[model samples]
Target: MRRVLLIQKAADKKDAKPEEIKKSFRTMGVTACQQMQGKKASDVEFLVSSKVGSSELLGIFENSFHLTNYENSHKKQPSEEEQEKDKEEEALDKDDRTKRINKKVDNFVVSTENTSVVEDQDYKFQQASARATEFARNLANARGSVATPEWMEHQIMDLLKKHEGKVGEVRVLQADELQKLGMNLFYNVGKGAISQPRCVIVHYEGNPEKKGEVEIALVGKGVTFDTGGLNLKPSGYMEDMYGDKGGSCAVLGALQ
Candidate 1:
């Protein structure tokens, strides 16, 4: 990961070829070679890397290359008009590609929407009803409680089933593994609850052929409700803690 460069000057007494300069560098334990451009003159420049300190490299650079005031004459300057033309060309190319891809996507999306309308009616209606009922119940009885209802596990399972095909496996982490990973934070926070704390992982594969390629990961801290614990909060603050599960809901929504 570290890089060192040794610049050598051209021979003065005798004109040296590029190959000869390269061979000379190899003799000095330079294992890597990099080509460089001379700043002052049209002479060729080189960058060589060796397992040597900067001071040692500098000494080699000075001794190998002859010092000369050779000014570079091949500097290229682009005209304003040429630069503008290149920009216009690039923009046009980008716009054309965007239009083509968008057209294909629009057609496919329309077809998919039409197909779903006819085939997914029954399942969609059932989901809509379930969601409505869940929403109404949460809104009506929004209270902070330490006990986690058994029904929450069923809900989590349902969520996992809904996203099973999209995301590979949904598994709860064992207590020992959780402790080893120092995830006692969740256990500590949820200790007072009647239900024991659980950590769940939702694994997904974006590319099935490339098994290990993980394009995305989503982690949700699902603390159903908070009562401020030992450091008790004001009644108003505790009331709002009932919505601590909002982050969990958001992640489920996005995955769906």
Candidate 2:
């Protein structure tokens, strides 16, 4: 990294396009490797996992490679022959139509800002989606006793804590509490299991500036682990039965 820094500093690095920054880092890596090897580091010889897509690689490296090293035309002085060619090109650039078109093409500040906003939105979407999917998948693979109602409650609590003050209030009603309240559905379903039933109600007001309170609400049953109770599991039917709480997982992630 220090060697690459000594080679050339990438100016307006924060301004480089996603693709441009990626190629620059790859070049920087090869250059650093070549310096150590005392021989050319063939970029073509570079290997990557076949399972990962080019776009996926970019997404993985985006944060680390945020500061790019792009070449600046003004930093390096042009040779006499190159200067002469530039002079000819400058003379030919007197056409107003071409110059106007080129000026418009070069100015991309507004578009770039809009693009960054969209990219951030996309990144957030992917993050929340992954959270939901992972919760469901993990529950599916975990043992029936492991991914219990209490475990699911803890997961949702952790998620709320991670988001901090964004959420308003959270209430977890246990088996005895549900029975007292005359809410028998949740209690009955989870009663058969080792761990008692728990109903988690998360109250979140998404909008503050609006006239009224939260306009929308989501409710889901989080059946963390489901093994056939009295009727024992038969054959392939019992596999991944814990994933039945996908609805609840989706709700938890959507709170993001």
Q: Return the top candidate by lDDT.
A: 2
How many clashing pairs does model 2 include? Answer: 0
Q: Give the best candidate by TM-score.
A: 2
RMSD of each: 24.6, 20.6
- Candidate 2, residues 37-140, lDDT tens digits: the string is 33211121223233323343323233222111111112346678876865676587753322111111111111122234325654444334544554544444
Cα lDDT computed for each candidate against the true fold: 0.45, 0.52
Candidate 2 ranges beyond 4 A from true positions: 1-132, 139-141, 226-228, 232-235
- In candidate 2 the C-alpha lDDT for residue 139 amounts to 47
In the predicted model 1, the residue pairs found to clash are 8-65, 9-65, 9-66, 40-70, 40-71, 40-72, 41-70, 41-71
Regions of candidate 1 where Cα sits further than 4 Å from its true position: 1-150, 206-211, 226-231
How good is model 1 by TM-score? Answer: 0.40
Candidate 2: worst-modelled 10 consecutive residues by lDDT: 101-110
